[model samples]
Every structure is written in C-alpha cells, then in structure tokens.
Target: MSLGSRSSRRHHRALQHRAIALVVLASVLVACVFHNGASNGSPGSIPSDLEPGDVVHPSPIPGSTDQTIELARTKIKHIVFVIKENRTFDTLFGRFPGADGVTQGTTCDGKTVPLLRAPDRVGDQLHSFFDGITDINGGKMDCFAQGGYVQYLPQDIPHYWAYARRYTLADRFFSSIYGPTGIEHLWTFASQSDHFIDHERPGQFGSASREFCDDPLETALAFRSMARQEQERIYQAEDEGAQGLAQIRASLTSRWPCFDVKVLPDLLQQRGISWKDYRGENPFVQPLRMVRHVRFSSMYRNVVDVSEFMRDVKARKLPAVSWLTPSFKLSDHPPTSICAGENWFVTEMNGLMRSPYWSSTAVILTWDDFGGFYDHVPPPHVDLYGLGPRVPAIVISPWARSGFIDHDTMEFASVLRFIETIFDLPPLTSRDANTNDMLNAFDFTGRPRPPLLMRPRTCPAR
Candidate 1:
C-alpha cells in the first residue's frame, strides 16, 4: 500500500469514531430530561394523582385515609389554586351541558322566572344569611326570584366555559360560607374562622361593620391591609341595611371566641413539602395570614408577589402547592370587567401549559362566593356556618377527566381535602374532614392528557 493511501484511511477511521461518540451522547441527553420528571412507568397503574400505575380514587371521601395517601404521593408535583370573585352556579353555569342546572324556577308568588342571560353586570342579588332564609322562604326556594335572577350563556364567559368544557367541572360545588367575601375567604383558608363572627353590626364592635376590616394591624402591612380594608368596606357596604343584614348580624354576634386553627399549608411544611401563596393586592390570603400558627411559622415566607410565581414557574422553582389571587381589576368582582378576569386566568394557565412543569401540575379555578345572584338547589345544610350557594369550579390537570361533570356535592374546603389527600397532610378542620375531595374528576391510571392551550376570547385587540 502507498503512504498517502494509509494516511487517508487512518483519518477516516478517527472521524467515524468521533461521530459514534456524538450519537451516544445525544441519546443520553434525551433520557436525562425525562428521567428526572414524573410519570407512571405503566398505563394501567396510574393513580388519581396524575401518575400512571395506581388506580386509587382521585378525590377520596373524608376519613378514607389510605386512598388519599395513595393519590397524594403521586406524580402531581404542584397544585395551583386560582380564586376569582363573586358568582353563582346557576347564574354562571345554569346551562352547562350535563350538569345540575335550573330545570325550573318557581317564584314566591307562584310564578316562573326563566333562567335567562344576565346583563354585562347584574347588580348584587341577595346572598346574605337573611337572604338565604328569605330566599328559601321556609324551603320554598323563592328568594332567588326576588333577589336577582340572571344566567350567563356560553358567549358571556367564552374562555371560562371553554376551559370548563375541556377540563373537569364540579357542578355541585358551593361556597364555604354564604354572603360576601370577608368571612367566606376565611372559610376558604381554614374552613372556619378564628374570630367570633357577627354578620350584623355588633353593639360592642360598633355599628360600623368596617371597623375590624383591617387585618389586625400586625398582619396589615405584611399582607397589604389597606386593600383588605377597602374590600371589607365593599362587602359591608353591599350588604349593609340590605335584604338580609339581620341574619348576617346574628351569625356574626354568635361566633365569638374565634378559635385560631391549623391550615392545610402548615401541614405541607410539616411534611417538608414546598408551598406558596401569590397574594398581590387581593384580600383572600389576608385571613390566612392572621392565623397565629400560620403567621408565626415559615408559612409567612410563602406569601410573595404574583410576579414571583411566574418567575418560579419559568425557572422551575415552583413549590408543591400555590395559591394565585389576582387583584380587584383582574378579579370578577362586580363592576370589574369579567373580560379582564378571563384574560388574567388565560394568561396564567397558558404560561403553565407552555412550561415543562405543566405535565406534573393541577390548577383549580373557582369563584369565592355567589355574589348575590340566584342558585336553585337549596344548599345542603352542613352546619351553622354553611355550605352556601352553589358556585362553579374547574379542575385543570393532565389527569383530569375530559368533558366530565362531577356531581359530587362539595364546598371550598373540599380543595383542602384534595390537598391533604395528595400530600398526605392532615385535614385542617371538620368541614373538610367529611366532605368529598373531587375523587371522580381525575383518573391517574390513564395516559396523561395533553395540555389545553387556547387563548382567551376576551383578549384585548392587538
């Protein structure tokens, strides 16, 4: 052989070896990206936790500790709770397909009011305790007719309806408490209030219902107490001297010696799981911050600006649990634009959908209260506090059932139950202890569903 031929052959052999090494390295890189992430190794065994492999119940009933434990410790690494403002089930979702909606509306005077499209804004309907008593009219279920009867068609909340139709819908979901945002928010957090609540103006509390509206001075600045004060004023101003002040006042007066209690996030930390609450100028997390233990513990550190949540999501620094609350303009509270609210939610979910972390996340979208509209199904009497009027809830997860309408009767605390079941955390209160935790909404044993990626219909003109 010639020297030139020998040198050319040697060079070709070395190039082939380098190309083979590159191929092997590329294969390993692909495996590493997915290997560290979560998914069921097999299709048949996915637990309701959005992981394939276990066929446990998704939202286990209260006291079913084993099933909850199995579902909680799954591939779902993060749970995001997004709270919107006042709205009723019938008014918002009465016409939702395959769900429990108004079959008939019988007025107190033996008349029938059709469930029709609500205006761009149907002012507050009576949703106070006295309103419930009056609306119930001794179980007649007529207060809805007199207060304000309006329903939103699909066109009204397109993005929300689209999201519900594609994701899981809990048709029988209700607010934890009746009436306005103040006490209801407390119910949302701890499932009960720590302060003695009196809906009516207390003689000692002063006729001004707005007196204690601030977050006890200490937590005020930490949680933006000024916003809380303003929101409290609105809730009180809306209900003051209205149709049901007597009942609201009576309850407030009765609920004294408000007992501070442990909440769900506290339990998560005890188990070393990560969690956070992105509370902008919103007041929902304010009551939670007032909880003595929650305030004193590291849980206080979990509350950050909403911008941080987005940053963490993009950076994959998301905690195991998250609470996202948009401020008033973005909230669907009365006079505020629902379009803005829808846009905010769509932007948030889309961000999650776009992120790699979406495969292992669950986002819950729900309104805080009925906002004084009308719902026909007389709320099932749970306790003195209440399982108030039915409100809409959407469970968004890769494991959530497609086009499924969960008829299981549930309240705000049910969110707590689901969190406890998945993370193996302790139940915060009796309200969540016996309630259903959205068991039928998810089937973790199946292949994870693709993310629902759609822009909001209400997005402003580009």
Candidate 2:
C-alpha cells in the first residue's frame, strides 16, 4: 500500500510541473515578439488592429535614413523657428484657403456662432490646463464660445495672411501639447514637459476660466498679478552662483517638479551644429527662463537677446538653428492688437530674406497653443501630455513648395524631426521619431525659388 501511494503522488507532481513549464514557454514567446518588433527599429505600431480613437501616427511623408540626411546636407542650411503665444488655427486663419478651418462653432449651450466673422478684438479667455480639458470634452469638438470664442480676420493680421498666400500653410498642424504658454514653450525646445501641466500658475487651475467669464476687468488685474509672481519665480536664482543656485534648485525641484532632460539644442551641440535661442521679453515670455535645461546648460550663454538675431543675420553669422521669441505686445496674445504681431513678423522675415541666408533658409512660423479659441476638429488621445487644438503653421523657404497646403497630421515635434533628419542627428524621443518632418511641404528635387517679398498692411501704433 505504501509503494503504490508514493508512485501516484509522484505522477501528480510531474503533471503540475509540466503545466507550469508550458505557461512559462508561452509568456517567453510573447516577450520575444514584442522585443523583436522594438529591436527592428520600425516606426509606430500597426494601425489596422487598433480601434478608431486609438491611432498610431507614423511619418506622413516617407524617406529612407540616407535620403533624409542627403536632403539636409545638400539643400537646406538654416532652419528658423518662431514661437508665438496662445492662438488657434480657426481663430487666426479659419478663412484660409485649403485648410480644415471652422466657419461655424457649436457653443457649450448647444447654440452655434459664426466663428469666421469675429469681433475686431476679442477679450482674453482662460487657456489653462483645466480650461483645455473642459473645452475638449472628450473630443466632442463642442463648447468653443463657452470656453472663449474668437476668430480673426485678414484685416487684423494682414502680414500673416499674406505670408500664407505666398508660401506653404499647414492647416492640420497641432500644438503637440494641450497646455498653456509655459508648457507649450517647453515643447518648443524639449519634445516633452515635466509632470506639471500648467506653466507655473499652479493656483489658477480651476478658477482661471470661471473668473475670466464672471468679471473680465477683475480677471485682467488678477492675470497681471499672477504674471508678476511667475516672472519672480522664474528668475529667483538668475544671479546666484553655481553652488548657491544648485541649493536653491534642490528646494525648487521639490516644490516645483522641474524635471531635467535633453532638448534640441543639446543634439545640435553634440553633432557639432551651432544654434541659438533668442529671448526677447520678461521672464514670463522668455524661452531661456521658462525651462530648466536652458537655465542650467552651458548653452544658456547662447541665449542672447532678440536684438542679436538681427545683428547676426546682417553679419551672415546666423547659426544652423534658431528660435525667436516675441514680446507680449507682438505675440498677439489676447487683449493685444494682432497688428503689432503682424508687423513685427513681416519686418523680421523680410530682414532674413534680404540676407544671403534666405536662399538656404527655412522659416517656420507657428503659434504656441490654441489660446482658448474655437476649432471644429477634435484632437486625438495620444498620451498623457497631449496633441492639443489646431494652430496655424507656415513653411517659408526656397525648398518649400509654393502655394501648397499640407493636410497631413502633424504636431510641434514634426519640426524637431525635420531638424534632426537634416542635421543627421539621432532622435530625442519616440514622439519626434514618429513625426512626418513636413517633408511634403518641401521639394529638394525641384529648382530653388527666389524669396517672396512681404509688407505690413499698415504700421501698428505702438
């Protein structure tokens, strides 16, 4: 009886062991599949298997690794990226030809408004993190006026309008992030942002939008107060020594989640490419002070004032890559006249084109984020950061296709992709790696065109 019972128990144990072995083998097979796919260095995932909302965005324009490098080395020599404050594609360029702009917007109360024809000047609405989430409403594309409805006309922004007519206007471009000025500006340099959503205005999250609606005058006063506080925070340790600032930064990082990461300027330096970031205004509108990378890096010395860009252009010492920031008055942020921004842009672009660098230059002018304005198209759910509302983008270069409208799906990272591919540098993250690089907006195979002239409709009163 003892031998028989022992044999039966041993047999039962063997069967359990075999079952566990089979489960382990199956798990290994799945891991191998994923690992191999990732190792292949293929682009995004296969799109067919996913649901409608769930999408995998790859480059809209196609080119091999070598082909991209060749284009960069042979055809282009300079890439100038201009960053403006809160503005939507519809609000700025809804009436543009061959864009997915909205003429009509559905209000939050189920009413419709003529977005194409808006006021001479619309009041500023809340464009904070909470405001963006409430406005999108899970991609229904509703609640624009409720959020803050304002569409601009050609008369208001003649320079931008005329520029679109002459060169390539990208209608389907997005902000890459659904955050306010500070966060979007971070994306302008770094493709990603810290965990912090709003710029630095942590206190005005839920109430910023409501307060704007309740009392416009009071909101104006409150915003000015907040701006002063943020500017102070941005430059608290500007004059501190390295060790002193490091200690202050330790405290600041704990209080503010100012995570450190690499940016476009880093890649440029590693590849022996020269670059510059032109900071123009107060700490609030400036690029160098907004992000931790520029504040700490040796590249911070490259952070010259805005006047330097013009000086370099005239001297023919312009770097390979450049980013220019505008003042509050010239940024076209609400409450400020678009005329000032319009004239400022025209003056800047005309100066560049008149320079010898114009032939080899590619000037990409785009807004920072949709400044609480209405757009009909809803943004897709990409990741925790965002692919916020549509914003107007222009491609002006000798290689840029003339009278073209790029309808491809793209974001701010697409610009980064272009620079990386051109410079033959490695990608910073998965996001920029998947960007289309707006290749279709360009035609290196074609003959180079002469610079298109521009003029302001009327000089803005300062």
Candidate 3:
C-alpha cells in the first residue's frame, strides 16, 4: 500500500482511540458519583440522605476506634448469639416480680381482660408489620385483643425464670422491626433489612420456604418505599386511620429477595476475624443465604449445620463470632411446644457451660418477634421500619452482672453494637451506630462468675 493510504488508516485508528478514552472517563465519573452518594458516611465522607430500600454502606464513627480497640483486648473473645423464634417479653415474663409487665390487657373497645394461661403449644397468631401497627393502636397498646392475650406461668418456664434470677434480664429490649422472622433475622446480621419488611410470599416455593436469594424459584420480597413512608406520615398528620395504613400497604413495591448490602460477616472477614453461622433445619430462618455475597462466595463455607456448633464447642473450636439458630421443633414458635424449646436451650447452655469456651464466650439469648402476643409496653418508635414489640433478652456470660435487671431500651441493633464494639469494627448502618453497646449488662472489671448449670425440666403432660 502507498504511504498516503497507510497514513489515512492511522488517522482513523487515532480517532477510535479518542472516542474510547472519552467513554472510559465518563464511566469512571459515574462510578465515583454512585460510590460517594451511596456510602453511608464512610471515612472522610458525609452521609447522603438515605433512600427507602437502599442498602446501607459502612460508616466509621469518629473517636470510637480507640475505645473499641481497648474493648477487643478484654477477656471476651467469643460471642455466641443464640436466636430463638417468636415469644414476647410479657408472654413469658409478665408476672415475674419487678419486671415491667402487666397481667391484664385493655381491648380496643375499652374493656380490660386478664391474660389467660398460654398453653404449652399455643396457636399461631398473625404478626405482620400491619398486625403490629394495629396492635400498637397508636401507642394506646390496647389492641392486642385482636391478637391473643396469653401469658406463661412461672411453672411453665421455670428454667427461663431461674435464668432471669441468676443473670441479667433486659426488660426493655425490642425486636428490630415490626415484621416477622425473616426480616428480624436480617436485622440480627446487618442491623438493616435493605428496606424489606416481611418474609417472602408464600406458596411460590412453599409456605415454609424462607429462602431469599439462593432459592431456585427466585421469589420476590416486599419492601417499604420512602415515598410511601413520607405519605404515611402525612396521612397520620391528617388523622387518616385504617384507610391510610391500607393505602401504604397497597403502595408497597417488591424486588427479588437477594440483596448486596454489607453485613457483620463482611467486616469480620475484612478484619480477619473468624465467624460462623450455625443454621437450623428450616431453610426460611437462614439470613445469610439471602445475602448474595455470603451465599455465592467462599464465605458460604462458614455457614454450617446446627449440630456443628455443639461439635465445635466440644472441640474448643468456637469462632470469634457465632450465630446459633434453633430447629423448627425447638424454635418456640406458636403451635410448637415451649417445653421442648426450653429443654433445647438448656441443653445448649449446659454444653457451653461445660466447655472451656464458656468463660470467654458471651451468649445473648433472645427471641425473634412477639408472635402476636400481648405486650403492654408500647415499643418506642425509632424510624420508618421499627422498634417492634418487646421481646425477652437474657445476657448470659461469666462477666454478665449477676441478678441484674437492666431496663435500658435496646433492640437487635444493640446486639450488633455490642459485637461491633468488642471486635473494633465500624458500624454497618446508623441503627447500630446510634444504639447503646450493652456494656451496662456486664462487669468486665470484676472476677468472672461461675457457670450456673441447670437441669432440663420435663414437659407437663398435655
């Protein structure tokens, strides 16, 4: 070819290269904007106004790094968070002395009804976000008549009551959200649910299927919209009642259950801290399975069966952070025998107490939701999502204050705060960032107390 023809081809190539460079620059600029906008106050960055259903990014609290580093040097090296299924604080400990519990409940129509004896296997009750709102009844707390007003006697849950007598019992702890199991589980790990409020829709995979991201069926989960929440506030201001709630519910949007949000494991992995999630039999209860990163990455290996927890404890191989969920039979969900649940809990405690990890481990025993049970105390409103009904929280650790009745207001985020503080990890969201770290429940300065192992009681014949 002639020199003139070669020069023409070279010019064309140069122009193509210039066009590609412009496109690359534009992509980089867009990415930077998205990162800065979505970062939840990352170091040296201001937080943007959070959108509804947006995944919260990490935010490091100024002046907290030093404090948390000192805490990580403490005797507690393991945190065993044992999460049980639904049962309200009042339902289990209402009549216990000195607790903020009531034996009677007021109906929506203004009649007072004494709490009935809850059966060993209570019937299932509706406890959706809507049900919680209706039961709260604009803070009057008298709408539980629509749900069930039942309480467990001391004889029924003697071991739990005994535990309260021996260890710190938090009377004011609430669920993270006003929804059911799946969302609450999400809060347990991430302190936020990516704005999803309820569980996956039933019947698509099966009524029992709680699988979110990893399910082959690819089910959609309902999430609240910030626009709808603002509208709800307006409706409340206008004194619109049931109709407004219905409108809000009708306006809800849905997305595939899978999410890309940051969770505690992300921080743990980054810091080289070991952790494990010992999941129960029911697939619906596993929260990490719904997180796309954990489910699909090498981190998935850390998700093990419930039995592995006991085995690990016996082998003295407990991780720095452990989450233990119960099987459906031992979940204490309504229609399941509470006796069996209690027995299972006691057995786990016994195993831990006998193991060497007990001294270094702080076990936080808590229920997931209220299960539509009557709780006289109205949950303090925190945000658009919740501070749902009160649930029982027992802090069982060698360093936990003995016989202490802690009334400090806390929720699932409080537990996250405790873990974050102990591990010197940054807060994943504003919820955990603002909540107290539960230092009030423990006395790390004093000598560690001896374990009080109790015998498993027999279930009464029904």
Please report the candidate that would top TM-score against the real structure. 3
lDDT of 1: 0.63
Q: Which runs in model 2 stand beyond 4 Å of their true positions?
A: 1-69, 203-254, 290-293, 459-462
Which model, 1 or 2, shows the larger lDDT? 2
Each candidate's clash count: 21, 0, 1
Cα lDDT of model 1 by residue, 193-234, tens digit = 543232222221112323233334211101111233343332
Off by over 4 Å in 1: 1-72, 145-147, 195-259, 283-285, 296-298, 459-462
- TM-score for each of the candidates: 0.73, 0.74, 0.83
Candidate 3, residue 233: the lDDT equals 57
Q: What value does the lDDT take at residue 244 in candidate 1?
A: 43
Candidate 1 lDDT for residue 419: 80
Give the TM-score (vs. native) of candidate 3: 0.83
How far is 441's C-alpha from truth in model 3 (Å)?
A: 0.4
Winning model by lDDT: 3
Minimal lDDT window, size 10, model 1: 46-55
How far is 152's C-alpha from truth in model 2 (Å)?
Answer: 2.0
